[model samples]
Target chain A: MKKNASLTRLFWTSFSISALTFGGGYVIVSLLRKQFVDKHGWMTDDEMLDILAISQSCPGVIAVNATFMAGYRLRGAAGAAAAVIGCIIPPFGIIFGLSFFYTAVKDSPAVRGVFRGLLAGVAAVIADVVVTMTTPVIKAKKVLPIVIMFAAFVANFVFNWNPAFIILFTAALGIALQLARFFRRKMAQGTGDR
Target chain B: MKYLELFWAFFKVGLMSFGGGYAAMPLVQTQIVEELGWINMTDFTDMLAISQMTPGPISINLSTFVGARMGNLLGATAAMLGCIVPSCVIMLILTRLYRKFRTLETVQCVLAVLKPATLSMIAASGGSLFLLSVFGGEPRDLWLAGFDWRAGFDWFAAVIFAVGLVLLRIKRVKVPPVLIMLGAGVLGLVFSVLPAVNG
Candidate 1:
């Protein structure tokens, strides 16, 4: 009974977070951290970071992935199910409603004006996302990551390259760099032993 | 038939999506806006705004909007399922392995490389959307020729965008995004209704 109640809590918590937080991805991260770590004492900050890492690394929406993992950590399969449903329901319902009414209202001058204004805000938020994401790369001060980052941007913006290709190319590049470092370390060890 | 098409198109989007919600925008744009003709460029921008305003993942929000616009509730369900199923299966496997293999050197290296790349993709995605929202009604040839700089630009949007950047980035204002948008909407409506601007 205690476990079931906790699972119910997990579901509501996940749902509310998913429902309330806008701007997606990183917003979800901060909110989840606050709820699970600071608020509930369910997980440590490090655990939250780890889940975030895994969520970002995997394919699909980061919010959903992160929540599912968090729920899984707390209460296993049932927890995962509850969280995923919670996260999805609000967006689905909202978007479904908007879609239905969009055609009728879209052409209204007031609606158009609102959307136009909203577009500016959206652009600003996205800009913040870029700035926030850029800080880590700048802090790393690694030439390779910086180069990959610029290359990926150029490829998409200028050439209109497929995003999948950019991801694959960068992953392969990462693997190759690791292999080179590994072999170089081995060679240095062999010489030292001699 | 449209349901199947929505499912298939979104399925491809799911398979290709990486980096996170914003990163998925270009892929979704490609599939839905460019390839499938499910939505026009203007509608695409509007959808992005709507998705951002609402809660949850942008990718799923986009999928639901596009699917419903194309074929109603069933279409939304099909597209949403298609968008999520691949990730769901992959993540289920990953959640298990992530517990054990997260410490591996290969994983670390891959993640490190992906970091910058993902950032770049997101920057590009944001750039494209910003471009769209700001320069949306311009002619294709005019935009490509770069001659539309003064003539084609929407000055009202540009002002709002500039003000918004300052408010969020410089002032570090804590205004919720929804409110900012609502404020902009009212301003826009006022501008449009004002005879001075419209005339």
Candidate 2:
């Protein structure tokens, strides 16, 4: 099929994107948008956002999951495989190579110093992560979401609750709220009909 | 047998880490540090720093490092596969049902809740990491032992942390994070050598 030829192109594109980006999910995402939307004109911004939402909703790395979604959307199962493998291979290979020499390099005083310095930098980046991640939630100005966000933080940091349990509880809470809203809307429609 | 253990451990981490890599840190910490005892606290933090510098998901990068440390190339392969397979399979299945689920009001609400919850988890992870880096990764008992809390703290790290916060958060410096990290590493090298010279 003609799709098969495109699949190889898709794979290499994903691989190059993954290989070049250094900052992780957010960086990779923006690069993906550029290639798929601006350069190739294959996907619209809204479609990309929708795919990103699906990727974030699932459990995997956002990069890998997005690659899978984009690949599947373009050319189906085989395409998905190509894209996922292409994206992951570079990072996997690099990290694998580094692992072999990590012990040797890690033992040096200078290396230890560098890693120690990295600790502060990591802290700063994480602090930014907190700010960026929470900004949208706060801007939404929804009381329930605001409350849930703080509650989750306290439960996690202060109580050391299992993250899985916290996620489950929030999911249940969301479902309950949605169910109640749905029933209320139905009741209102029923009254109008009568 | 060890390879199997590495696979299963990372597999659970892959399946359960909901928000993303940062949110997964706590679970990864517990698994690798507490349960498996594969690495110590210091090494874990070092791995985190290294993983951040690497491309891809932090989880995958970490799995690769941990696996290689345990069993060379074969171990690394196992860990990497374990970390990803669950997600790959789940995504494949979900991709099929995605059209139906995306339209559901319940699914929307669930995602809405998950976004804030996941953000909160990331915040908490940041807090714990800050404490660990500043306090030298000792258990709480050591901190509570007496009034000599300074004994357990790493003042160098604490100072660097404050400087970094000021540079990025308050000054709104447009520097990339990797650059900042590298600068701090340079500072670390200088400081390490300084003590040797002075003492």
Candidate 3:
């Protein structure tokens, strides 16, 4: 009974958070920290940080991933399921409703006007993202990462390379760099033994 | 046939949804807009606007919107499934081996390069959307030598874009994104109905 009560709380909490928060990803992080860390004492600060690290590390939508992990920590598999379901309902339901009207009104001139403006706004917002995301890389002062960034821009913008192939190539390159570093450390240790 | 195509496209999107939602935007743009022709650039921008306004992951919001646009309810379900299945499966594996997973140095190495690459992808996607918004044509068309660059540009949209940029520059969350889009939409409504702006 206690467990069931907890599961239900998990569901409602996740549902409310997912329903209320916008901007996705980073937006949910602080909110989750607030609920799980500060409010409920369900998780420690360190655990929330770990969840964040793991969430960002995994290859999925960061919000879903982070919430799922956070839920699992709170309870278990059932908790994860409850939280993810809660998280998805808002997007799925809201989009499902909006899609219908969008198709209907899309051809209307009034809607077209709004859409035209929305398009420009979306572009500016994306530009803001480009600035926010790139600042960290520039701050790091790493040449290789900068070169890779430029190469990627050229590949997509100029050459129209498939993004999948670009990811694969970069991943392979990164692994090779790691391997080289590993061997160099090993050789240094070997010399130190003498 | 289209259902299968939607499934396949979003499935691939799921597989590559690394880094974050923003990184996945370009991949989704490539699959749906550039490659498959499932949606136009204008529609793509609209979808992004909707995603920004709503809650949940941008990736999921996009999948649902695209799927709903393409194939209705069943199609939306198929696309949504394709998007989440990868995350579910990957998370399952990750949860089990998480302790070992943390020790692997290679993931960080990949992320080091992947971060910049993802930034590049966002820029490319943003650039395409920007061109489509301001110039009213394919980006490829814009770059061609003989293209009518002057006539192609939409001055009304250019002004909204400037306003949006100014809104974003407010530094801190004084102006939320949804409001920014709403402000632009208001501009659109007023100007779009006007005599000169072509309703």
Candidate 4:
């Protein structure tokens, strides 16, 4: 029972993190790192990173995955459920209201202008996020991902290639690389055993 | 044929989305445009542009727009429902289980890969968005190119972008999205009211 209470607190903490973060997942991550990994001593940085990767590959919202992984890490499947719900309820409630009146808001001049202004700010935020995220890849000496990033940028921006194709292709490449590396290690281990 | 399949497809999308709503673009484009064939490439592109120009998360906007396009009001409703349901349900479940495994190392490894991938995907989507915003129509002639760039980079947008960035950097103020959006709308109203700008 004591364990369950603590788990609930962590879930709510994550939920609050998601609910309050202005810029979405990446910002949420920084916040989670501070609150969960640093302040609370809940999870290590590496564990957070791993869950983030899995969440990306998986077929759901990143926030939900983070919540699930954080929860599961703490208390198994049931904890996972609690964190997921906590993260989602706020956004769902907000979006539901927005959806109903979105058309009406669209016609308002004031609303339209604000969005235009927000677009530029959003662009800047995205630029900041890109820089922050790429730091790790730069440090890791992995040129392939960087090259892929540049190629993707040019393909979508200059060549007008379909983004869907680029994503699918790169994901396949990542998976293939992982699998090949696994086989090579296995083969080396087999030789060593022999 | 099956509503459940439709629900699951979107639910999967909603659950894995990270970085932001834009991160879901490639997945959505793949699922709906390529695999499902529910929307054509052209329409999907069009919807993307519309979603960008409008306020709100691109994914939700696209879901609503596409849902309406695909199956009318109900379809829009279904798609929206499909998108939100998984996150809602899952979050509820996780809220209960969060504390026990908070210190687990295994969980962190998966997040590391996902974080970068999600970032890359968002960047990729940003590229697509730039194209949609700037170059979606018939190819502009050389003479028209200058005009488009000049007109498209409106002063209102530029000013707001600059101010927002400064605020973000210096003050570290977290400007609410709603307020920024509303500010833009007010500027538009001002422009509309001004004869010179309106023309």
- The most accurate candidate by TM-score is 3
Encode model 1's per-residue lDDT on A1-194: one tens digit a residue. 22333877888988898888877777887798898888888887888888888787777878878888888788887888888888888889999998978878888877787777777777777787688779878898989889888988888777778777888888888899899999999999989963
* Maximum-lDDT candidate: 3
Q: Give per-residue CA lDDT, model 4, range A18-119, as digits (tens).
A: 666654554565676687777777777877776665444444455555666777777767777676667655544454444456545654655454444444
Please identify which of the two predictions, 2 or 3, would achieve the higher lDDT against the true structure.
3
DockQ of each: 0.64, 0.63, 0.75, 0.21
Which model, 1 or 3, shows the larger TM-score? 3
lDDT, model 2 = 0.79
Residue-level error in angstroms, candidate 2, position B119: 1.9
The DockQ-derived docking category for candidate 2 is medium
Question: Candidate 1 chain B TM?
Answer: 0.86
lDDT of 3 at B198: 79
lDDT of 3 by residue, A46-121 (tens): 8788888878876777878877887777677898888888888888999999999898898888898888888898
- The candidate 1 chain B region of ten consecutive residues with least summed lDDT is B137-146
**Model 1, residue pairs in steric clash:** A114-B185
lDDT of 4 at B51: 52
Global Cα lDDT for candidate 4? 0.58
Interface RMSD list for the candidates:
2.2, 1.9, 1.3, 5.7
